[model samples]
Target: MEDTDFIVNYVKSKLITINLEILIAKDGEDGVRKGQIERPNLIIADLMLPKMDGFEVCQQINSNPKTKDTRIIIMSTRNSKENVLRCYKLGIDDYLIKPFGLDDFEQRITRLLYS
Candidate 1:
C-alpha cells in the first residue's frame, strides 16, 4: 500500500495480523518503485499522492507486462464519478472511498486476493 502514514498504519493494524505483507509507500513514485521491485500480488493506492499520483501509477503498472496482472485498488476521498471513470480507464481492478470500515476493507481485499 502506498499512502500516507495514517492509512498505512490503519491498514497495517487491521490486516497485518492476517498474514498480509503490507508495504508502505509515502507517495506515488515510491509506490511504483516498490511495486516493480516487490511485485506484490495486490496494490492499494490513494489518488492524491505526492509526485506522480495514483492514476499515473496504475497506468504504469498496468502497462508493464510484469505487473499487468497485479490487482489495483484505489482508495481516496475523491469519489466523484469522473475520478472513478478515470481510474477505470487506467485499468484499476477496484476502488474504495476513504474512511472505510475494517470489515468493508477486509472483504474487498479478500475478494481481490482470493477470487
Candidate 2:
C-alpha cells in the first residue's frame, strides 16, 4: 500500500470511536492547500511528500497566522535524531515514527486533540 493510504487507514481506524473529518492529501502542496481551506483542527504529515516536502508544509502552516494554531503531528519513516529535533524546532505538536502501533497512534492523537 502507498504511504498516504496507510496513514489514512491508520488514522481512520484509530479515530473510528470518535466523530471527526479526515482529509487526504496526495502531497505536501495539497496538504498545505487543504490546511488553509479546511482549517482543520489537527494535521498529520509525512516527511517525504511529493511536490513539497513535509517540512515545508509544516513551515508554511506554522508561519501562517490562520493555521498556526493547528496542531501538527509528523508521521514519517525518518526517525533520525536530527529529523525529530528539527520537527520540534519547527513547532510540530508531535512526532511518530513509521511502523508505529495502533495503540500508540491513538494515544498520541488523543493527547494532541484533548490536551
Candidate 3:
C-alpha cells in the first residue's frame, strides 16, 4: 500500500495482526519501484500521490508484462465517473472511494484477493 501516513499505518496495523506482509511506499515513484521489486499480488493506492500520481503508477504497472496480471484496487476521494472509467481503462481490478467503512474495505480486499 502507498498513501498518506494515516491510511498506510491504519491498513498496515490491520493487516499485520492477520499476518499479512505489507510493503509501503510514500510517493508514486517509490510505489512503482516497490511494485516492480516486490511484485505483490494486490496493490492498494491513493490517487493524489506525490511525484507521479496514482494514475500514472497504474498505467506503468499495468503496461509492464511482469506486473500486468497483478490486481489493483485504487482508494481515493476522487470518485468521479471519469476517474472510475480511467482506472478500468488502465486495467484496475477495483476502484474504492475513500472514507469507506472497514467492512466495505475488507470486503473489497477479500473479493480481490480471494475471488
Against the correct fold, how does model 3 do in TM-score? Answer: 0.92
CA lDDT, every model vs. true structure: 0.88, 0.85, 0.84
How far off is model 3, as Cα RMSD? Answer: 1.3
Tens-place lDDT digits, model 3, residues 1-115:
4557888877777667656678888798998888898899988888899898889989999999888988898989999999999999998998888877767777777888877
lDDT by residue for model 2 (12-51), tens: 7776767667787878888999999999999988888888
Which residue pairs clash in candidate 1? none
TM-score of each: 0.94, 0.91, 0.92
Error of 2 at 98 (Å): 1.1
Worst 10 residues of 1 by lDDT: 1-10
Report the Cα RMSD per candidate: 1.1, 2.0, 1.3
Q: Across residues 11-81, which tens digit of lDDT does each residue of candidate 1 receive? A: 88877867898778878889888889999999999898899899999999999988999999999999999
**Sliding window of 10 residues with minimal summed lDDT for model 2:** 1-10
Measured with C-alpha atoms, the lDDT of residue 33 in candidate 1 is 88
Q: After superposing candidate 1, which stretches have Cα over 4 Å from the reference?
A: 1-3
Global lDDT for candidate 1?
A: 0.88
Best by TM-score: 1
The better candidate by lDDT, 2 or 3, is: 2
